[model samples]
Target: MTRRRTHLRTTPRGTLRAVTGLFLALTLVLTATGCGGDDSSAAASGDGKGTITFGYTADYSGAAALAVAEKQGLWKKTGLEPELQVFTNGPLQVQALRSGDLEFGYLGPGALWLPASGKASIVSVNMLGLADRVIARPDTGIHEPADLKGRKVAVAEGTSGEMILNLALREAGLKPDDVTKVAMDASTVVTAFSSGQVDAAATWYPLIDTIKERVPDLVEVSETKDYYPKLTFPNVFVTRPELARENPELVKKVVGVLKESGDWIAKNPEESEKITADFLGLPADRLTGSTKHVKILPSSELTRLSQDGTVGGWFDRLADIFVEMNKLPEPGKSTDYYLSDLYASAGRTDRT
Candidate 1:
């Protein structure tokens, strides 16, 4: 495969610079306490009827519920005036939450450290790890997991991309070291793989779209859905711990809205996708196949998953991975991050 020259924004040099910034930001989050001012008491005493800011990434599959909720006036129906803000990734949302700039956020496994470090709290789960994939160049002779041995595989070191890569390699009776690993950010990996700098890349959507657009002969390889419940990487909704504790009523209301929105999306996927695309200012068909790639659980399912330890188990497994990668000092219990009582409280109310 010939390398294609393009003016992609995420270059190797830029990513290298980001590595240190990412590390320091994470370090600060872990080491600091009460990063956001003490506003829980003030927010809780109020009637919980005001303009609240909901933060999310530009990812349609992850934040589709928010788009639908806003467009359908669901929040207003419940006496909430919400303002949505889009961020580039989950960590930034965590920062905003800590700084008291945001009330709620939708995030993926990449920001699980927020909860693990007690920097934020996971209020609910959004979806499973369906969007991540391991794709290869057609000319690389790498058609399957077993074919990846000794080949250069591009993956972000500690993100879901690496998790999927390790899982795929294990299934093929191969170790991570069996393949030549190229450490890069998820976005940078997309450009590198498309330009023939790496044989395969473990990344997720919209980035995958970039590779598909630039490289015509992309090979089909493994995806996160293949492992399903065995290896779970969850996209989740989070809020500050103080908010969850001081304002249980508000939490219940938000959860009810999320449930209503998720149910609507499940029943009317076509309309939901269009709403998300339009809200994010993308092509109408940009999220066409997203349903198959991201398993969005209806808000109603949160209570069941919470009661049965399913959601908790997913986070526990994720924490195990973090420990293995030395990102965590030790494994964290699911209760340390997951607020299971929120689901139970939301379920008890008729609002949901």
Candidate 2:
């Protein structure tokens, strides 16, 4: 539960060079059509006056904390009429966004990369801080990251949870091949680990809490710190590029509302916890610990996180990791290719 500090260095020279080339190419594409052209009229609006279909997916029945956030009408409080969907995993939620069935939703850091590079023009508008944890049962004998070698680890394939495991392995001076990875859903990871099916499990809250409740002597190994300093800022709010350009104002409103709701949560933790627990159908007592760990960074923090290539730099590093792990097709351009205007608009200094 200790906070890990990350020092953000300036973007590496090679990354900057590649970003420069990509920026020029993008500029050429934009200039050919006239630089100052505005597509505001082409954008979609809400139902007549103030209703829009914001989309969201979570294992509401399973992951109580996320479910609580959704069921509490936090998005609605943020002026978004979210059309909620339930998905078992992050990859499936990203797929829903790619198909255009949903315009925007929460996603993992890894899920944002490929779609942004390919057919889906996704932009990370807000970042929900690290909500995942890595836990090992007492019987498994995994006292630390180094203990994971040759042991069975259950992870849901293509999730930020799985990606965290990969990053942790590298941090521990091991490789993915060094352990036995058993792919399983979030609900089953703990049970699988308890039954000796796997030595450890990489999963998020509720599950981690559940496992710890069942196995009190379970060892806590490397967590978000083991990965990119701050758990790679796993849960992020993302939208498609076309949607953002067409309706920048709406996007701005959505972000503004989320910021307000997050602020409210920060001020009224006990009430917020009650709302979350009731919505997720979990005991209010269990809510205190889980909610305390969920850090909702302010919109200003999100703005700084996106600016000066911090977000881009992280993506580049993630891409390199993906390639090294052989998880992606190839490393893609991180700067010019990803959208930043939403954060720019959200943090606009001159609103007049």
Candidate 3:
């Protein structure tokens, strides 16, 4: 016998209601056996008695120096035990957050939109200092941004480095099509540049440091500093909405710790550099230059940064750029989709 497909429109509302009731009954039974959980099982307390996993993506191996501040108890000062997970790039880190594997993590500002669109919601709670820099081998004959045209450049695809490259190209009166984009992971870009496989590479610090070491003739053609007043960095801390709602206090504490750590870093640059080097397992000397230039933004200034449309607006601008690049569906309203609630949860209102 063949089974007939039930048409809800053909059935009376009362009949439809009865069928829905039966379906709900079955669903409840399955849920009880497989999905139901108590508060303890669902959320862990972090009184230093239990572990709350804090995820982070830092350049542990390649750009290890850049991530030193984060890896070395910067988050812990806020009284949270963070389990730092290192990845080569932000895209993978964001993917882990969407899969529910991370409670919080750092990702490039551009990658935050997909999660903010309700597929998965995350808030940008903290902004790491701008860490991106663009470098080129002298042999490539590239002296300026305009010189990049027709040259093969290596950058991590779907990352801030790539985004910066695109923006830089436009500023130089060139389009992305004007230059060859060689997609490579950030970790490998340094080696690729050293081997002459790529004409130029755009990446963040310690990779930039490494490239400089191998190619003394290499020159920094452009940097965030040059574009700044107009350019913004790509780093931000993000967390899941559910966790932020349940543990707002803990979130505040974590932010406090990061702020304290930032102060310490500013005051004791040499010691902080050593701690960062130890944490990343890199030779302390190679990281000295990178650390000297590193700047940690203060949490107190976050309010002003948000209010003046610097921090929040940066994300909004990045979303527009993503749309123009066809990386996102369309640019959505920042108020509707961004992590304003997380900021509020942190007791912040003036996110300028």
Candidate 4:
């Protein structure tokens, strides 16, 4: 009988690092793609070995690339043995990172509320979620974006949903208080709409797509614009500064595997959608519809985008909205939280 060796450890952090080196070194033996290639990379913790404990939001498709790559055994292919930590949302993953329960995790604008620790930095933008839309029921007579005025709108407070809704309202010449707002998490936004708990919901993909299928009369109201110019919320992977600097090879492996995942998704869109659908237990169309709302950014682009004012702008816009909502005490600089060097070091030079 053959045995399956997983590159995961449930031990204490110190011992965990030791075992990680052993297994990671062993994993390298399994595949050269798992290690080497980068002529100037090594483990920060001394000898490179063991697996990485990666965290992400399992349900949201924006962060699905990591899960997809993990499912395809690409981590093994790259000589990365990863034990995944799944979270319900970006904030929860951020909490885990803050608590040192996770070395790295995926996040969104929901993290704007967090204070800049200067402890961790965004390694890459996993995907640009042109996410969070204002959807209205046809019965409500909310036709255009302006019709949301005086209507009951469901939004998850202190989240990207509210930010998106607020931005849409501004575009339509309305304010947050103009509409009756109901606070609900992303999960309940759909039910709130289906049960008529609210006239409309400022929600994101998967749910937005689900409401469309479940509520045929659903009126597409508004969506956040590309933040390259608009600061559209992005899903990013954050890692500890020390890990990124010391274990550059590991960082390269992570970013490289993520890029590989993007390529796989491009080549196998249908299979990718089905896997995510089955995982989310939503219809495949819900996943397919999501493509229209998000663009998965490769790590290389993240490397380029992170350098200039673009990503900083996205953070600034988020900080402004969050402060407007009184979600943050003050606006914080996005540059403080993201380290582009790691992505730059890991990015494929051959790609345009």
Candidate 5:
């Protein structure tokens, strides 16, 4: 059965539907493999033939590379019959990949922990996390991070929004418990904050713009970009390890698509944003400042980062933060999940 693509606005306004049955799916796959399946090392196996179901988040900025690939015919140019699916967040995409519902997907910081914890393999690092922000209603008088103390702030736990909020609170010498955290999905954050049900909200774009449009005077109390150097957030590409190991050529082709689309996006920022805006049914002007929020590095730079272990270090640091927050039992082994050789395999080494 083909899963229908979900757009950001299409999900229920105040609900974050959990993708249940992950354990069941994995259990079934493992049982099948043990019973007399092919000699594939991983539970989920793909021949890398036929239509490739690609998953991406449903936002103009997050889907920029994919939208470009689709619009410019890059997928077919690379000999891939692509089926693009839109997910509301990274965990859902991860769930699909584990169940063989998707061959590849783009994930944000919120879901990066899954891959780091051995849920999937990281093939590429595509986008930087700069869109996360905490916006407060002017009447709340939450001008600074410390002002959040005792006030209700809507933030989705286990997402980038929580990371941004925690880092901000740390800088302000405030603890997580200092403020009242109103846990909600990204969609509900907008509704709860706009209705004055919460004092402020922590989220990312294009939802940042969405919230601003509702409360014109919302204050940007904190943003992930402000915590750079000490902290870094990334959006990455992932696939099942079994698929990458068995069909290296297919994985290489997908990497090629990522490099091609990323290179095109880097050289043509304005045109790329326009293409993404049109693809997402959003007005071009709404994406005016969106390009600056995500650092879409060129292919050469990505290769350099992968080779030097810089990319792996990024995940390690993120895992440390999660561990401190008690989200993970321990820090994940970056090398275990991040396949560093894929960049060179895709031939993106030339620093052009």
Candidate 6:
């Protein structure tokens, strides 16, 4: 089960495949799916022990913290064997998470909404800010939000980027039908916008930074914050209820690993960037926006965010947005499913 960590080349098309190889520290890769008890809270390794299948979508930097933690030897120290099953997006990971394949998943708030509806619970928050955005060419004369009307917007289908684009339109007093929707992958947005293939596009960090670099006339039209102040993509650490309850020790340890990883990222950024870039298969310079814009909250901050209602409050807002957007049937209460209790208990949990 403990296969070596091998570096997989990122394809231009952005299709995901199961990866295998080994890193300097303890790293394992696997492609197996068998673990959940359909819509139950016991979505964890049966005895709170054994190899953990971690489902991840690494196309975005928000989920890179897991790679950082692994490279830094945090998972090994926690006595937990983490076998990461690579994924292309949250929906794919959610499918794996629901079928009892993934014990842990890292995703943005928009993606997290799907699993939260199930037995999954988001335990910690990380990488929140202006990571994703709407970019357009200045020549389009789209200087203001209102100008987006009648524009051809390239938004990746089935992604947080699209969700943000819709929200941005709603904030601009525009409807989804106001503009021409050119469905594409997030990776293609940059070329689509620059080549005039689309007048505008919704994309994330490295691409956001890239367009600014490649096209000087590029104007970042909007982001998560411009529409809704509380609406930013936060990579919430989600798990099944039982994982947080039965495996408090493991949960706390994983949180500790994340805190250590964040600390390492902040302190040794230059080196951290190199490692992350290698793992993500992007240029080190391309990752600059990620470290600059994303806030990798440590366990301490997560505890505070939980205690102060920030985590729950943010989730509540997202749920409302989804409902209003007609993406969900109804808005669900945060307390009903969110295991903010995990963050509350992470600090006091007996880790022995």
Scored by TM-score, the top model is 1
Candidate 2 Cα errors over 4 Å, as ranges = 1-50, 58-100, 119-131, 137-141, 226-231, 276-288, 320-327, 336-338, 347-352
Top-scoring candidate (lDDT):
5
Error of 5 at 212 (Å): 3.9
List the candidate 4 regions with Cα displacement exceeding 4 Å: 1-47, 60-63, 71-78, 115-119, 139-141, 195-197, 213-215, 226-229, 245-249, 274-292, 348-352
lDDT of 1 by residue, 1-352 (tens): 0011111122222111122123232233233212222333333455666656677655555568787887777777556666565554677677878998788887777668668878889888876757678899999999999999999999888677777777788789998889999987666887799889999988776568777899978986898777666557788889988888878788778877877787888788778888876665566886666677667776657677788888788888778766655567987798987988776667422354
- TM-score of structure candidate 6: 0.75
lDDT string for model 5 (174-225, tens) is: 9888989988877788899989999988787767667778898889998877
Ranking by lDDT: 5, 1, 4, 6, 3, 2
Question: Against the correct fold, how does model 5 do in TM-score?
Answer: 0.76
TM-score of each: 0.80, 0.68, 0.67, 0.73, 0.76, 0.75
Residue-by-residue lDDT tens digits, candidate 4, 127-227:
67676678888899987778989999988776667877888787789988999999865667778898888898887765665677778878878776633
lDDT of 5 at 146: 90
Global lDDT for candidate 6?
0.62
- In order of TM-score, best first, we have 1, 5, 6, 4, 2, 3
Worst 10 residues of 5 by lDDT: 32-41
Prediction 5 global C-alpha lDDT: 0.72
Q: What's the count of clashing pairs in each model shown?
A: 0, 0, 9, 10, 0, 7
- For model 6, how does the per-residue alpha-carbon lDDT over 94-185 read when each residue is reduced to its tens digit? 56667776777766555656754655777667567566677788789887668989999987754567667777777789988899989776
Clashing pairs in 6: 4-21, 4-22, 5-21, 5-22, 6-21, 35-100, 36-100
What lDDT is reached at residue 217 by model 3?
84
- Residues 1-352 of candidate 2 have per-residue lDDT tens digits of 0011111123221110010122232232232221221222222563212334333322221233333345454444433443343333345545556676555555545455555355454454343435566678787777888889998888876555676677778878999889988876656777886676777887766566667677777776766654554336444565666676677766766555555555556566567666655443345553555445455555566567767656666666666666754566787876554565565555221221
Return the lDDT, model 2, position 253.
61
